[model samples]
Target: MSTLNIRKITPTFGAEITGIDLNQPLTPEQEADIVSAIAEYGVCVYPNTGLTDQTHIWFSRMFGNLWTIGGQGTRLSRFDYPHLFEAGNLTPEGGISTDEMARKRRAGDRLWHTDSSFTKERTTYSLLLAHEVPAEGGETGFADMRGAYGALPQAMKDRIEHLEAEHSYLYSRSLAGFPVTEEEVENGMIARHKLVHTHPGSGRKSLYIASHALRITGMAKEEGRALIKELLDFGTQPQFTFNHYWKPGDLVIWDNFCTMHRGGEYDDIHHRRDMRRTTVMAYPPPPVVMDPRFKDRFDPAQFEAMVDA
Candidate 1:
């Protein structure tokens, strides 16, 4: 493997990595270097990789287990791969979907979030490959959570150091006015995670807040939401974010542990923005630690019923 060409996109976080063939198998050294790059920079963009869907999924597997869409084989109509998320506006007939549910779900992607945070088995890295891009306004914005944590006042950091938050996929989609369906609730879309997470490989601490994070455990809902909002507003300041404008053949990968991302607006009704994502699961799946307070909202029986039904 040749030495990778890495150019910084931002002073602090994102980088463009070159000199690797996505069509071929990655050497162990190359793989390790990519992992280390993600640990250090959070986002790596490989411009014009010309990766096919098969190659994209293959490359993602080199990192870890791929997250199956929706914890089941659930997928959008006309999309072939169950392991890949169809993160686009196009429907089976290649036009923008008219389905209200699909449009509402897509709208929810505008919120800053860490991938799969609502699942007990959260994701580690997400590799998104662009197949089709609109002529304008479909950039994806990413915020540096590690930098956010570093910039927080000492008192603020100390306050949230040991705190935990309840994350709910249902709740987040609801915020976009998408009512939760029974299947989503039964899919175990709620989980609890620490407010501050220390990356094992990088030894860096990052704020773990996301749009999926509904409330802080043991705190009143209104107060917890206020604090969460305050943190999100501060963390997503211009200094901490980079918006990636997509081009066809671009493959961008980012570590979910240290970043929050949201989809930027495009004329979804008139143009197409076809992006597919393969999510690599965090190894040894994070334990499901439930807060009794949220049990009413996230019942174990619902999941059991889902399994039974």
Candidate 2:
């Protein structure tokens, strides 16, 4: 492995890395450098890597265990690869899907979020590869949560230091106007995570709130919503964000522990945009303690059993 041609895309958080061949296996030193880059800069982009589904999954596994689309099964999956998430507007046959569920899931991606936050074993990294892109728009915006935490007022920092929040994908999808069914709610897709976290890899404090974070644990629902909104707004300020305009063959990786991301708008109906992603799970959070307030909606025993395996 030779020296990586690293260039900072912004003063705060993103970097564009070159001189690495995604088609081949990476050396230990090369892997270390990439991990270091992620710790310091929340997002890294490799332009024109030309990674296919296999190579993309291979490169992602070099980091940690992958979060597969298992619970929902292959019914929602577009590609033959179960570990690779179909994040684009197209179907397996290379046509835009008219499925209502697929459309709503894409709509939920527009909100700022950290991948797998609503799961019991949250994800640490997300590697998104753009196989095809629209002629215009469809950029992904990333916000540095580490920087956001540092910029908070002392009082705000003191307040959220030991707080915890409840995250639910079922709830988040409903925010995008996806009608929730009784059966889906019975699946118990809720999780609990610290409101403020000390990232073990980077040793930096970061805000862990996202669109999936529906409410603060033990707090009034309205109050929790206000606080979560305020923190999200502050974290996603212009200075803390970097938007990546996609081009075919571009691979972008982001550390979910230190950042939040959202998909930018494009004419998905008119033009095809095929993006695939592999999520790496790491730093397993604490067990989800059932909240009595939401007992009617979630079963704690079911959540633990589903996640433990």
Candidate 3:
């Protein structure tokens, strides 16, 4: 592998990486260099990848294992790619969803959030490629959480240093006026993560505010929400942010731990903005124990009954 040419997209956060193609196999050294680039810069953009779905997935696997959305498969109706998820204006039926609820659900992506924050297996990195970019507006905005944490006042930083927040998909969905069933709330999808993430590889601290972060644990609901809003505002200031305008065959990879990204607004009804994403899981899910102590929980009959109920 030769020296990787990297240019700063923004002074604080994003980098444009050249001299690599996803369609071809990357050498071990090249792969490591890309990972190093991600650790150093929260987000990196590779222009003109022209990668097939298989090659796009292969490139993603070089970084880590793929993370799939629980109980959901590929959203592209025409495409049978299993390793990626649609992050675009198109519906599962290959048409735009005209339904209000579906539109509201998709509207939640415009909020600043990190992927898979609501799951137990944290999303390590998110790689998105644009195959069909809209003509007008389909940009993705990313904010630097590390720079956000660094800019916070000492008192503010001290206050949230040890705090934890409850992240829930239903919580963010409700914020956009999307309906949720009582059963869905009962079987809630939620996870707890530190308010400030200590980035493992980079050895940097980043404020972990997300739209999915419903509330701070042990704090009053209203107060916790206020805190989240405050942190999000501080973390997304212009100085610590970069917005990527989409182009066909462009790939953008971001470390979810140190950045918050959101989909940009576009004419959903007229324009087609087809984007696919491959998320690298932080680690695989923990193994299920089949000990007698956990017998009742693992019992198939009991699980079937619960599902029926």
Candidate 4:
């Protein structure tokens, strides 16, 4: 079994792990060590690691089933391997806004978010490899949600612990000017998640809120809006974030359950940057039932009500 050399960055955010070739299969012992390191550090950065599409997909499978987004293309051809999903520049010229790449550009350029926050079953882990990087800008930034929670005022933390927030792809896409179809909105593909979620394997508490979070349940509309704004602002402070400037051959794996990430702007018009990402579906959280009274409050039926007020 290969041993991992792990170095933690901050009390809450990142770690640099070495001593394993991602190209080869890991023994059960190596897998456990890697998983344990991830639990201890919300993000792990492996430098000088060259990973091919096959190797990347194989590494992703070691965790659990991969997450496939609705409209995004699958990682490899379905005939090859069906579970992984591809992310980043997919255009021929390696440009960001070719007609062929517009949808991905828009989705990725939007604010910080956990992968698939809109889905009922959220993603657990995300593995991304830098294939090409811009000479300037386009750094990926991550915030330690666990650290964000720990830094919150005691009263604020206490107030939101049991509160739940409604997360909807429809809501987030609307903010970014990409509205979802009516069919998707009806399927509960959009879900309500607790404001704070406990990590299943590590027992660490993390702030589960994000930029895409639409509203809080059981709270007045104005109040919920204000609270969401406050929490977002607090949780994304500089002290809680680590910005990664990429170099090719770098594979980063992060715990999506305890961290949030955003894409920083680059000179998309002048330079080219491309990265590939594979996400793992999370082990489901406990069940959450919508209150009958509030069901219509945020649903299509209340669109007019929301507009009227």
Candidates 1 and 2, the one with greater TM-score: 2
Per-residue lDDT of candidate 4, residues 25-79 (tens digit): 8988999988888887889999888887667867877777565433344323321
62-110 per-residue lDDT for model 1 (tens digits): 7776765543344445555545787889876677776787888788899
- Two-way lDDT contest, 3 vs 4, winner: 3
Backbone collision tally, model 3: 0
Q: Mind giving the per-residue lDDT tens digits that candidate 2 earns over 140-230?
A: 9999999999999999999999999999887778778788874575476789999999987789999998898888999998999999999
TM-score of 3: 0.88
Tens digits of per-residue lDDT for model 3, 1-309: 445899999886789989877678777888889889999899999999888777787788777656543345333344554457878767777776666766788888989999989976678899999999888887999999999999999999999999999899887887767887646754797899999978976999998879999889999989999999999999888998989998899999999999999888888878888888888867643355433432332233432343355
lDDT of 1 at 90: 83
Can you tell me which runs of candidate 1 are displaced by over 4 Å?
70-77, 180-188, 285-309
* Candidate 3 residue-wise lDDT at 137: 82
Evaluate model 2: give its TM-score. Answer: 0.88
Better of 3 and 4 by TM-score: 3
Better of 2 and 4 by TM-score: 2
RMSD of 4: 10.3
Better of 2 and 3 by lDDT: 2
**Judged by TM-score relative to the true structure, which candidate is superior, 1 or 3?**
3
Q: Report how far residue 160 has shifted in candidate 4, in Å.
A: 0.7
